[model samples]
Target chain A: MSLTLVLVQTLNGLQLGVLLFLIAAGLTLVFGVMDFINLAHGVQYMVGAYFAAWFTAMTGSFFVGLALALPSALLLGLLLEILVFRHLYGRDHLAQVLATFGVILFLNEAVRILWGAAPLSVPVPEILSGSIVLMPGLLYPVYRIAIIVAGLLIAVLLYFLVSHTRAGMLVRAGATHPRMVSALGVDIRRLFTLVFGFGAMLAGFAGIMIAPILSVEPGMGDQILILAFVVIVIGGIGSIRGAFVAALLIGLVDTLGRSFSGDLLRLVMSPAEASQTGRAIAPMLIYVLMAAVLFFRPAGLFPAAR
Target chain B: MSDLVSSASTSDVPATPRLRGTVALLVPAAIFLAFALAPLLVHAGLDPFYLSIVVRIMIFAIAAVSLDLILGFGGLVSFGHAAFLGIGAYAVGILASHGAGDAFLQLPVALFASAVFAFLTGWISLRTKGVHFIMITLAFAQMAYFMMTSLSAYGGDDGMTLWTRSTVAGSKVLGDTTAFYYACLGALILSYAICRCLVVSRFGRVLRGAKENAVRMEAIGFDPFRFRLVAYVVSGMICGLAGFLLANHTEYVSPAYMAWQRSGELLIMVILGGLGTLHGAIIGATAFLFLEEWLAGFTEHWRIVFGPLLVLVAIFMERGILGAVTRRRR
Candidate 1:
């Protein structure tokens, strides 16, 4: 409503955007490279948060918890790839979807059994615990800002890793022309495992970073998984740049829409009807955005050259 | 042995044509026969609750059959199929709330609403291919889910309960447990017949051709998109009918009816029965619901077992229960 509130909401949206980017980055890359649709990707995010919550409580240090969670997440991803996902690479997308969905069900329930149904909380470390004044009468949580910064840093680092290095070259090549990459005698299998593991680690990192602020709970990833799917679809399945752009776009649009739709609708209709309609329309804004984008550009904004 | 397995598992081109033909016809007939006689079994003191479960199975089987029209035969993996189900359920709920509790009125409205929704979403969704299509459908379904949740006038997130079942021409036939069971069975039979006919017709051939090779189908002077859209609409209508039955059976309607997870379960049903087989969808719905019910009785956290079982099915049971049965017989 007010300028300060709008500013705070925008920052909140950015934080959400970065977190989405972290999750979508791994998802899109795995999708692009392996052409494997891992529905369990969201569960990996949930697992990361669970690991962080458990470790943070055990170690009594957030940093140490993060350090441990990252590898654990990576190892879990690799183990899945080796056990369940590897066999699925040759199967159709439907099989991949079904298999991963099973993984989601398993992991979600397993976490519930392990951690119980109640949501777990991670205390904000003392260094990043307080709110900072952004401007006059505008204060924001430092932890959220840190998430945004961390996400951006990862994005930059991912950019360098994907675009500048030899492995990045292979990944890019794999995305565009996988058979060609394989024909050139690259160990496509190893590359797939690495990409799958790395993507899991990135998603895990996102989970670990956001755990302090958000409730670490079972099935938390399901909703965000849908949001991240919207991100990758809007971004173009295999394009990291597309995922980044789309993630921020969705984040901003979703946050701003939820916050402003009622006020905006009030100008055109009665306050009561506007509020009701706005409430109905706000949660659907991102989906509408996605449908419109796909309708106009079926392959998305930046379709990877396949 | 590996070659034999591969040959048997090739669902599209069955290795034993005559055997498969007989099995396909017999499976549906046997399934329907069991359904038809299920009420008698309940009447004979086999637990009336079991009849309710079968009724639920028939309702979901209708949904699964409709989904197989697109997912199995047409190769359009619509992850939002549950939206139509919710639309149908909500139609009954909303109309019933306003005192329009006639079966004739509720059925048509539910069917029409689902048709319109399917047409619009499918038109956009079919523009993309493969994974994009899947995600787009999911997004649209989420939109539907959110819309339903926002309807505070209609119970919102908590959903609403129907006071009584819909009256058939002002008669309370549906209120009777046996009559309702027959009604659901009759609807499932009718839906199965319609979908089975569609899949075998020339129209179905075009749909299947598109799945095999869209470019080739296009080159052969058919517009795959138009056929797919029509199929999508028909499929939506049937699933809506299922939703109508689901509401009547459960005496409730909620936003949860259209959740993405429900859509996923629908997909699982289609896949679990055996893709591209109408009867398989029915078998799948039965198998899935029975498994869930059976597992739930053992412990509260049954998904721990069911989840891994699904993974094994995906990894091992490529052709589902139907395929497994046929393979074993061979």
Candidate 2:
């Protein structure tokens, strides 16, 4: 609607976009490098939030909680890879999907048992608790701004690491040709483990960052995981740049669609009908965008060379 | 037992003459026979509640068999199959709410809607192979789910209840629980036969050949995509039939009928029973639902036990329960 509302919603969209990027970056990489589908990847995000919540409560500092959660998340990822995912790499996609789905079930239920079904909330740190005025009348939460900034910084860091570094080159090589990379004497198994762990940590980091804003719940990651899948699919599987671009595109489209669809519909229809149709259409905008994208380019926006 | 062994091993080892005549007919006949006798057993002093459960199993078995057509035989791995189920149910619900409660009318509408959906989405989805196909199907299913949720005129997120069961040729025979059970059983039998015929026909062979090697199938003067698309549409129609039965069985329709989780469960059922075998899907539907029911009897947190068990099945029961049974016989 108005300029102020648009500005605030834009910020909200950016925040969601960054969170998606964090999760999708890891997802795309794992998918690209290993050709494995990890449905339980979302659980890592959930675990990260729970770890942040529990650790923050114990340590009495958000920063301390994050520091603890990151490594723990990484460890959990490694444990799962060693126990479950390692066997699935040699199997078919159906097997991988079913196995990981089992992991999701176990983890979601485990989280419920550990921390009852009630949603756990994390308080925003005192320093970033209040809203800061952007323009004359626009004010936004400082913590959200912090999340956006942090996400952007990580994206920049990821871009540099993926494009410039030696390990990054190996990753890129693995994505395009894993068998070739393995044949070249690189330890592809270890590389997969490393990538898988790092991706889990990144997803966990997203969870930890968003903990203060969103309710940390058992299945919270499931919905976001679907959104992240949409991001990767639209962006192109296995492309970080694609994930980043698509994540932002989806985030903005989804947020702005929800915010403005009613008003836009009212231009043609009665207010009541507009609101009802808008409510239905808003949640579907991203999927429509995804379908449209796939219809034109089945491989996605940035198909990683394979 | 001879018929069961013959049917179970017939398609699996078609290369050998000894196995060719057996035609895995026994298991399915046995399965249907057991289904037919289940209600009698309930009358003979078993829990009457179980008859309803078997009816539910048969309803899902139809959905699972439909999924197996594409997933196992066609190798399409459609992750949105539940959407067709929901479409079928919603068609029934919407029609009945508007005072049209005839099975003859609802069945055609459900099948037609599902076929249209499958054709359009399959046209797009079949373009991409592997994981892209899976994700796209899921996204489309989610779109359908959201669309259903947005239909505030028809209950929206909370779902809607059907006031009465659909009438068959203006007869309210389906109103009785036993009659409903028999109706569902008849529907499942019809669906199974349709799928069985399709999987064994020239069309089914093309689908199987394409699944094994699409390039080879293409080189042999067959268009794999067209075959796959047709198979996808047929599969959707059958799943929609299951949805129709489901609406009648529960007399309720909700957006939850097509959730991605339900789609996942359908995949599990197909895999659990053994993919590519129509009767295996029936066995899987029975096993999965029974397992859930048996586990739930212990505690509400049944998934905690069921989850790891699924992982074990994926790891150890690679061929599924039917495969396991057949292999042991060999």
Candidate 3:
């Protein structure tokens, strides 16, 4: 209800939005280019968290761990592409969903096997730890602000890569009309591999970034993966700009709804009833938002040309 | 059963039955008869544990058979069918908690709750095709799950335990394992028969035609939406009945009943037995449950092995167990 609290929540929402954008970007691209739904995309995010945790523990340096984690995540993505996803490209969406689901089961268990089921935490870097006052009586975590900044930079970079690069054009084409791209003599398979790999790395990067704050545990990606899917669906399946905008919107809505639903409901109902009803509705707000969005724009906002 | 139902629903199939068609039908009938005898096995000094397991399998089999109604027969791959089961289970839990322990009362409420949910969600979800439909159904199910988690009074995340199973005409027969097993078997057979009848009906043909080619079906004067919505509701009702039995069978109900993972499991069962073949849902559910039971006996990390097995099935075993059985008959 207070301005400072709202401001903090907004910033938190933005940070969460950034993470979702990173994950959604990869998923949308893989979906757009190859018409494949990689349910295991979330597992790649989980893998990045585990790999970063392992490397940080081994090297005793957070930055070094990140430095090593990126390429390894990319390799992991491409390797999965070759091993499981490649064969699924021409198959139906059901097949893709099932296979990727298998990948999730395998990876989640593999992580549990390698690292016990107990939640693991990576400490925030000393330099990024603590809070800064954004206004009178309003202090926010410096690490979260850094996450927002980093996420925005990636957004700008992604915008540039998609709009200005030849590879980006191909990706766009793949989403809109893969057959046309095929007719134009480009190796569509290799292009899909590139896009899929890049998407995997982006998800990995998000996982590594968030490991400090959220519990890095098995199956953590499952919920976020669904959220990312919601983001892409609201933004329009193949549209990066849609993903960015929708991710932020979803982030803000979900966070603010959770924090303010009780207060908002109290205006019309008794305190106890309001609070209980608000609590129930908070978790469902995003899904409600998605349903409303789809009602108006069945294909999502900023639908691809295809 | 969806595989067979789909054939029954679609008109393009040649009138001539395949040489193995009788064998395929017989295989599932044999399986059902064998399942019905599970309680007998227990009474004859075989482990009663197996009866409980088979009852659980039948309960899931009911849910899976309903799913095949839409997924296999109608070509609507709903990823949230478990929500219906959850709704049905919750219906029993809520009513029983309030003192309505009668099967007649619980079954109607469960079916009504699930049917209404299916009506609302299906109305919205059926508007989209393919991947969007899957995601939308999944989203709705998750919404239901979150709602369940927020229900602080009804045991919330911990779930609720029934003091007694549902009564049939004021009789306590359901409290016995053999009685419960027969109840479940009866429900499964009735559902299978209803689904088969629906598939062969004219309305079902329209749903099938739409699945095959909506535009063509539309040209033929069918409004695909109405047929699909009806199919979705019918499917939800049957699954809801399963939920009723499940609540009694386990004497427990939780939000976990509607988890997306359970939905995934249901889909895998339908696929494993061969999609579109109604009876395959039973086979798939049985195989999947048995595999889980057998594998867990070997190691705590059975999921690691099970995961790869799912992957192998997805990648290579396209026709599933029923398909393999009928193929061999040739």
Candidate 4:
């Protein structure tokens, strides 16, 4: 393996990891705080991408598009929360699962109705479009590096806000004991609204950021949503820190596994057979990793609440 | 029905039968009988297409019933039950593609592979509770799904087509639509009966007890993990059987059959029919598939309507169709 290829792949893995963290942070929080399972969270990602795509196309400016799209995404999320999710809180997990599943079905089809089934793509902004040389004979895309930096910065900022701020403390407390938080005379409902809305926007932001590189289509978020679930499960639901670490871990594992598993297998066996087996097993390696994690620490590596 | 099963233990009253109990058992039996006799009565009138729909319903009903074995009765919500189904289907498809279409050999192979996967996944998944457990099972299922997608020798992403259905005593019986429908109906009824007996049995009592109060069950000397694990395996095996039937039913197996959406649909079948009720699985499958069929016939955007309807069901109707019916009787 050449050093340049390894560095490039590692950078790609980090970029992917950061994006996953952004989405998973919101997901784990919604899950931990409300004890609600939202399958439609992926659709919010889809919506964000679509919103960005549409706004960018209309105004011909990525920054302007994002400035307009983020709040709209947050509003849409809050609207859904008020109309549907609020009713589902305190219900059994089955109801939450079913209702959110319904939202997924609706939103996926709705997107298709609105944008057709063809995959859509957002153009990389002109300023961040090109690549920069990293090491001797190696170069990486500036946009992807930007994504990594932005994602990490968000993660650091989130840590500060969650661990050092009152809202973060309330969020932590609410995750463990919702009733106690309500009894403290804080408008628990407002807190939940902020949490849910903010989480949705974060997911949407990840979607928009990724739209340039990944295919933007209906049902695009479905697979990643499950992976995000894996990330949260391995990271501990409702813990942003856990989400960040686990998201990066899963992203690295999945990305690296997909890239090198065939080569790794070819070292031991004939090319054809190794490639076949590697192709078959590589995608599942992360899931195997998750299973191993859950087996040892059922609550995940860093559970935020009891 | 898990609700019926658990309510008996939770209520203060001992050994008192509610009216809803009788209806729960009877309503499902009637639905089963209707489907059982469907081919005989509609054989002359219905087209092959409609007959096949009923057969599809029977196949999914078997899967849903097996899912209820764990989700409804045991309260171990498994999002990856479709993995077992896919494993079973793929087993039959791969075997048949390799010229091993005999039921005796294919069925055991399907059951064994699915059982092993279930046991391994369940062993890890059952260690967690609530959302962790749900997500873990889902991840495991996704892993299986990815594996299936990578099996290029077996048609991989596009899916493998079975050249022929399972041969039973050197006959073409399964090739006939009516015969296959009856075969599936028979399997559904048999699985339902077995589930009925198993849930009321001593093993079942312990499983349901764990669902009600894991701490209490543990206190009383039962290891909820082992009991739930066994239930998970049994449920997986049952779903595998349904998968075997599914591959045989369509003579085609694809990764799409085991998609997470399929798992979600299976859960929908359980909840919509009335969770924890054995017959509810059948009812849910029938209603869900039939609704899809009817709605698709009416409009292309049926999902738009169906999604909101489901949210409404979750928000307003907590008990589901069967639960509502039974609750009113009480």
Candidate 5:
């Protein structure tokens, strides 16, 4: 690939990575703080996208629509926590898995019933919708750059909240020792609710932000959820910093592997054979990375407070 | 309470193993009779569609039971169990497409592929426990799903359809619906039997002990990790056999067969039936399938109700269906 193409792909990878971080940040935090395996976290992301898309279509303004959608998504998260997730705490992991998976089934079908089965889209606002020239000969979508910027901004905000705030201290405390935090009389249950809700909102935000470009459809969150899981596993569960770093690494590896694996293989093999083998092997690259990471560091690259 | 005392005394008086043995046979005997008789009572003379559905349920029951072995008894909670299923199905599908349509050859290839995949993935996954282990297994399975989807040579995401079922030593035994149903039933029964034996065996004791207290097991000089790994491999192989039956039943294999959702469904089956019990898987699979079928019939949005139902079950049922029953009987 040419230098311009390489640079563009690299940027694209970074953009994807940041989006993953947005999803994984909430997931890792929830896993860390609540010790709950919320499979429906992906459904929250899907809900955000669908809600944003529908609201934007109605309001005819992306920003206003997103502003409204965020609160609704958070409300939904809290409602779900109160109605269902509250009961799952202290249960075995298997129970949590089954219960959350049921949530996934319900939400995915609910979205399908509400929005119809076809894919929906949200429009990129005119101001940042156009392409921007990054180099002499290359142009990148302004929307993608916006995503990268927004994702990083959230990451910085998260770092601050998690490292500087009292709530963050409680969150970190809960991650390492829930019983001790409760013994300290910090209302651990409420802390867990807040963490779960916030994580849900973050996931929803990621979904809404990316809605303009991606297909907003039923089960949209499933694949990304798997990728986020990989990021956390590679980065170390319960570690936001690990999730961020690992998300970027996986994003780059997955995106670049898809784009260049075939061409890279062609250098040493016949074009047809390279294409076939590359296609077969490309999907496995991240998993191989995960396995390698686990092999070297069983806890993950940067395991959180735990 | 008096009856319990009398039964306990009687059981304590030298014939306890025999009594326990008879009780163990009771449920499966009842289930066997029902399944055998249900086909006879069908309105449309054993509607092929229902037969197919039941067969599918049986096939999945095998896989679910295997997963329960690792998750419930061994405390492994693998999320990539579907990968073994996919491996087995793909092996059958690929081999059949290449003219090796004989069940004898296809079975070995499927088993071997599944065992290898399980061995490699389990070797790494068993290192982690709880959620990390779950996610790692899930990631590995997703990798398998994506790889299968990318295989444009084999119909890719749409999946590959076998023109015909595998042959049995130059005979077309699998082509017969009744025969195939019985064959799958046989497979399911055999798997259940093997699991039953395994759970009470020496190996099963160690596996169960690890689940109860890994630290204690380690303290007692058992390397719980290795035992868990072996269980994982065996569980994976068992799921692979289920995959083989599934592919044979449907005559089609798709990436969807190994989706993480399917893995979740398998977990639901195990829990719904009862954790740490062999027959629970069979009941769970049947009940789950029938519930879905009935619910979907009532409303297209059945999962809305089903989802809440699952949450309620988790909230209220600490020991699951079978556990609740066994406790009451005790």
Candidate 6:
């Protein structure tokens, strides 16, 4: 890759990483605090994209549509909490996994039923529709750049909240020592509900933000959900810092690997053979990285010192 | 649940004092005997379609039963068990593509590939516990899934059609549905018996011990990892053999065989049959496949009902199909 192409790919990777962070953050917090394995969390992201698509068209203004989506997504998250997820807290991992697997089947099908099985698109807002040139000839999409900025801002805000705020302390404390937190007269159940709801909102927020750039369709979340799980696992299940770092690393490796694997392979092999092998290996890049990391550090890089 | 675990061990023996003459032994024998006569039923004008369907179920039963050997008895919840199935199928597919169509060659390659895959992946996955174990297993399976989809030579995402089924000592026994059914059935029985014997052996005890309390097992001088790894390999090999049979039954192979959803279905079958019970896997696969077939006939959107049905079962039924039957008998 040329210097400009490399720079653009790095930015693209960052954009993807930021989206992953938004999804993984909520996932890690819930996992850390509640010890619940939610296979259906990806559906919440799907819901967000679908909700954003519908609301945007209904309202006919991108800002108004986004404004309406956040609250609706929050309410939907809460509704799922009350109806299904609340009862699952004390169950074993198998039970939790199977039940949530069922939820995935239901929700994916339900979305297809409600929205028809076609992909929906949200047009970029006029303000962010054009590309900005970074140098003499290098150009980047303004909306993608906005996503990176928004994601970074959220990361900073999340760091501040998790490190400084009272509620954040409770979440962190609960993650590391739930029994002690409860013994200290904290209403652990209430705190858990708040965390779960907030996590849902974050996943939803990720969905809405990416809706304009990607297809808003059923099963979109399943693949990303798996990626989020990989990030969470590599980052250490309950660690936010781990999630951020791992998410960025995975995003960069995946993007850069997909873009450059064939060229790298061509240095040693025939072009035909090189491109095929490269294409074959590109999708497996993150998983290979994960296996390597896990081999050296089985508990993950930031396992929250429990 | 604790009682179920202990009871599972007792039932492993041929004639336990407390479990002598229990229906568990009787019911399983009757079921197998019926399966042995399934071809006869086809001769009696039973739908040929039903024969193929049941063959598919039995193939999956082999997979699920092997999964139970580890997931239930060995206390290893591998979320990527389908990867073994894929590896096994690919071994056969790849070999056959290269002009090798003999079972002796294809099946063993399938077994070796699957065992190696399991050993390598299990070595890493077993290093972690709980949800990490689950996700790591899943990641490895996703890797297998992605790799298979990118194998452009073998038809890639579209998969490859087998020109011919594997032959047994120069005879095309696998091409005949009745013969193939018996072959799958016989393999299931053999694997089930092997797993049952393993469950009753000393090694099985260590594996089960690790499942119940790894620290306690460690304190008693058993690392539990070695035993779990063996169980994992054995399970993968058995599932691999199932994949071989599955490839023959369908006369095709696809990347879908290794999809994460397929792995989930294997786990579900093991649980639906009641975890840790050998016979439960067979019964669970039958129930699952039957429900899936019946539900799909009702509508294209059958998953809507099927999904909720699975949820209800997970919530309300603690013991699964066999668990309830055995419980009521007691």
What docking grade does candidate 1 earn? high
> What fraction of correct interface contacts does each candidate retain?
0.82, 0.63, 0.52, 0.90, 0.65, 0.53
- What would the per-residue lDDT of candidate 6 be over residues B60-129, giving only the tens digit for each residue? 9999989999987876788899998888888888999999999999999999998998899988888877
State the lDDT at A25 in candidate 3.
94
Off by over 4 Å in 6: B1-6, B9-22, B43-45
- Root-mean-square deviation (CA) per prediction: 2.4, 2.2, 2.5, 2.5, 3.3, 2.7
Weakest lDDT window of 10 consecutive positions for candidate 2 chain B:
B13-22
Q: What lDDT, from 0 to 1, does candidate 5 have?
A: 0.84
Candidate 3 lDDT over A1-306, as tens digits, reads: 888889989998899999999999999888877888888999999999988888888888878989999899999999999988998888867777777888898899999999999988888988999999888899999999988999999999999999999999988987898999999998999998899899999999999999889889999998899899999999998899999999999999999999999999999999999999999999999988887777678788878887
Better of 1 and 6 by DockQ: 1
Error of 1 at A39 (Å): 0.6
lDDT of each: 0.91, 0.89, 0.87, 0.86, 0.84, 0.87
TM-score of 1: 0.97
lDDT of 6 at B279: 82
Provide the DockQ value for model 4. 0.83
Off by over 4 Å in 2: B1-23
TM-score of each prediction: 0.97, 0.96, 0.96, 0.95, 0.95, 0.95
In angstroms and one decimal each, the interface RMSD of every candidate reads: 0.8, 1.1, 1.1, 1.0, 1.5, 1.3
Kindly list the per-residue Cα lDDT of model 6 for residues A94-123, writing each as its tens digit: 877777888889989999999989999999
Deviating ranges (above 4 Å) for candidate 3: B1-24, B43-45
Residue B210 in candidate 4 has what lDDT?
Answer: 87
**Per-residue lDDT of model 1, residues B114-218, tens digit only:** 999999998888988887788889989999999999989999999999999999999999999989989899999999889878876789888888988999999
